[model samples]
Target: MSAATLLRDVFGFDGYRPGQQEIVEAVTTGKNTLAIMPTGGGKSLCFQLPALVRDGVTVVISPLIALMRDQVRGLKEAGVVAGALTSGNTEEETDEVWRNLENGTLKLLYMAPERLASNGAQRMLRQAGVSMIAVDEAHCVSQWGHDFRPDYLRIGDLRRDLDVPLAAFTATADEETRIEIVEKLFDGHAPTIFLQGFDRPNIHLAFAAKDGPRAQIINFANARKEQAGIVYCGTRAKTESLAKALRDARHSACHYHGGMDADDRRNVERRFQQEDGLIVCATIAFGMGIDKPDIRWVAHADLPKSIESYYQEIGRAGRDGAPAETLTLFGPDDIRYRRQQIDEGLAPPERRAADHGRLNALLGLAEALHCRRQNLLSYFGEDPAPCGNCDLCDKPADVFDGTTPVRMALSAALRTEERFGAGHLIDILLGNMTEKVAQRSHDQLPTFGVGKEYSRVQWQAIFRQIMGHDLMRPNAERHGALRMTPKARPILRDEATIDLRRDTIKSAKSGPKIKQMVSEEDAPLLSALKAKRRAFAEQLGGPAYIVFNDKTLIEMAEKRPKSLDDMARIGGVGTKKLDSYGAAFLAVINGEAAAQHPQRQKLAGRNDGSIYDRLLETQATLSRGPSGTDKPMSCSASQLAKVASQKPRDEAAITRLLGDRAADRFGAAFLDILRDA
Candidate 1:
């Protein structure tokens, strides 16, 4: 039967998704192919339809037993003969699979990548007349990816041994990962690559800084109530606590993590698949194998480790193509935790540096000023117009050119010999007479009391943004001491500038007070401000309230400030706002130069900004008095920026960027610094 007829008769689909037709055609024609489609982009149909059209049984090498079983069960339900050979299979199930193979009735055979390890398994496929190989989650073969399956590497060997046309599919793989996939799977031979668009419009992206995170999660789940969702936590304990919290909120919830008993994990997986309206609070271990498509929402209780991991995790939601929502709550702790996780890993310096860069990309997304989808897709090298589906699209953030404040923070880190964490450094910035400040004599520094514009909380937020910018880093060896990176040096030298989210910088008080956003008297002005907010939000493509919530606007309207400084005195108006709507709102109240200063900046600091500086310094040391130096000796600032920005996970890309001379002298050393950074 033709692929189209099979789609209609077996899979019950009338047509292919946007990118699937070409991939199906390629695979159906028995050509080696690589398809990188977004999650929920109908990737299974691409291979399944092709399998029915192609002669003999098609062997699908999937990563997880659960995923394989789910796909096989799905295919069988469609009246297509399919079965999986996995450890999870009962003896009867295995017998049925073998019976189908013997009877020449099975159209598709699903097996985990681990199956490739057994010569007997390969022999079985070889004897079963396997004509084509379909590898799902193809990026697993690439070591650079977050989900590296060593077993996936064996599929390339199996492909060559079988000599079948291999077709690979994945949802997440950057250029480097793609290169590795090709080199490893196709043996450096280019396949018919179908680089599908990564945009998932149905998924509503939203991020909020962690202010009362537990309550925030409870409120989020409460709003979504009965819909199926997943809440990903950073720690196993957090998963249990959060899941209990969700249950206490009267929702059906359960927690899963790698630390759980294997049987318990399997049970949760089964429950999530079969039951509707079940919320699973889990660590990173709970996803990837999950094939549930109707998940209505996804919430991240902590920041994911890397951008790839984040994309893949969030991609799990809204897979059924219906509108789904995502709320990723992040804060200074999340950033530090993620950074420390990477730093503490056993991976080499280059891999760790690349990991840090990946984290930074996610940080940038969390602290995004405009459309989250636009910035997100850009990470995959596909640029498209702003998507109006994200929380940012609903209302934009108030931003400011935070160069001055950031410089002050950087200067404090520099002046303090990069020895202290953000706490002591913040004390110096806010002129706090803390005992630690006195012990360190930080109060005597030239940069002391420089950042008196923002409060301690506001300063902490700035430091967080600085980390998001990746201009600094926490030194693991130095006990998480805040340090300057190469990216920050330029800003400190007044040669560069950066914009920060003012709304994130200026947060609300923690203690409970008024629940209402605006007073009854300021309702109309609040509405006017909302209308203004909506306009600004549409301009930046964020949720209106996210930019300037009702409370901030009420404060703005009630105070009716006469100037920028006057409005600055309002509840949420302090801190830097480079891309701010503050000026426009100041135009609202016809505020003069603005409100008076509340007090000096104080509070916390961040550590992620210092990674890049170490990389640059490593290059610099190799450049000086170097007898083993290459002709160029050192990379130029722009070249180093390329190194810093497009973090080369491997030496090949770094070599290509730096050229032979510089790569030879500085390559290994540069990689070492990236590790420490």
Candidate 2:
């Protein structure tokens, strides 16, 4: 049958997806080919159609037994003759595959890359009259690729041994990876390369800074309660603990990692395929082989190791062309951990540098100030318009001219001779009297105390942004010390400016508002309460709700409780919260800042808080009777807060709060402002 007739009769598809037909035509005609398509863009059909149209069986080299078996089952169900040779198969299944191969009834034979390393397997393919070689996950042949398989290097030898034309397919290959794939597989001979667009418009992209990350994951999982999903974690222990946490939250969850037993991992894989709405909390070891198409969502509990890895992992979702969602949670600690992983790897300096660049690409995505799809596609060499599907596009980032802060950071780094990490640099900028600063006399520098307007957390975020901009990078040789790139030169010299997202620095769950947290008026107070919770969480190195959940914080904001007794009466706040958080929350309700002076604390999140400051400024401007000729007089901050809160209607009431002289001096202007408010 022709390719089109075979495509219809065998696979039951109406026609190929965009760009697949050309690849099929190339492969079917025995022109060596390399096709780099997006994950859900149907890379399988490009080879499968060609395999069927060509004569003799096409030996498919897939990475995972599970992936091979899944595809074989699918092809068989479609009435195509397919079988897999893998350790995963039962003896009866292996005998059936051999029978089909000997009888020339098998149109496709799937094998893992490792089998090619054996002479016996190579001889069998030669004897079995294999017409063509189709390599799936072909990027695995590149040592430079994230999912490199050593046995893939032998595919070039296999092709030579069999003297057959080859077709390679992969979803995650940048220019470098593509080059390496060509060199390694085709031996410097260019193939018919099909580089398709990497845009996944159906996948909604999002990111959140890590704050109560467990709660964030739980909330996300609970919201989409009955959908199948995958949660990729960075470590094995995390997968297990997070899986248990999900179970406690009453979701059907399981953990998978390289550390798990073979049987257990296989069982998890089997269950994931057979069961709907099962979430597999796993490390990178899990998703590469999963062929499930209805995975409704994918979340990264921690940042993936690189951008390529991230794209491939999230691509596992929405494979059926339905809308899929993804959330990647990142933090300063995650950045450090990722950097350390790269530094500790044994890759050469150049490759390590490339790896760092890949990581920087991911950081840029996390801190993206535009549509996430735009940023993602731009990395893969596509220039697409804004996709109104990401969190940023839904609500454009709150951005500010961060040029001043960026310069301040670069100046501190340069003045320190580029020897310090973010912590010491932040200390120098904030003028902290740390022993290291005293020993190095960095506190005496000009940049010291210049950044006190921002907190340490905020500065860390700025440093992350600098790295994300590729204006600065971590020095692996110097133990992750900061180093400036030429990109920072103009910014440091005051010739260039930068804008940063203001909302991301606030919290991770800063996206679409959580439901029923508080009334509109009480939202700010609830936010302040969450900030306090985050502070405590950061200190304890725990998730935010270790102190109090949102419900409790929502209560605190709404009640505006006055004392420990009042706090104890709220739900979720028992004796422990009364003792531990009561004082701090009471202070917040009384309009207190964490470190600000008592007077300024009253000015937080309250209308009068702002009005009180406006009154002070109005008093200052008119203190000398608006001309500097009259006597100077002022109202205390408390007196200003009282007057602003009471909003005295006339001079008689104003005089009661502020003495007659001070009140008479500032009353008229204050009344006008208060009346308007």
| Candidate that would win on TM-score | 2
TM-scores, one per candidate: 0.70, 0.72
Clash pairs, model 2 backbone? 591-601
What Cα-based lDDT does every candidate model obtain? 0.79, 0.84
Estimate, for each residue in 1-677, the C-alpha lDDT of model 1 and write its tens digit.
77778888987888877978888899999999999999878888889888898889999988777677777778878898999888778899999999999999998999888878888998888899999999998988887788888999998898898899999999999999999999999999999999988999899999987778999999998899789999999899999999998888899999998787767888998899999899999988777778788999999998888888888889999887899999999876576556655654545446756776677788888988899999899999988898999988899889888888988999898888887677778889999888778887877899888888888778877877787778876653343366677888789888998888988777733334435454423433454455557777778888877677667876776677655445556776545541265567765445233432122111001122234456656766777536744444666766766665566767898899999877877888777766655
Q: After aligning candidate 2 to the native by TM-score, how far in Å is the CA of 248 from where it should be?
A: 3.0
In terms of lDDT, the best-performing candidate is 2
Per-residue lDDT, model 1, residue 345, is: 55
Off by over 4 Å in 1: 259-267, 413-445, 455-457, 473-490, 508-677
Query: What are the runs in model 2 whose C-alpha is more than 4 Å off?
Result: 439-441, 506-677
Lowest-scoring 10 consecutive residues by lDDT in candidate 2?
507-516
TM-score of 1: 0.70
For model 2 the TM-score comes to: 0.72
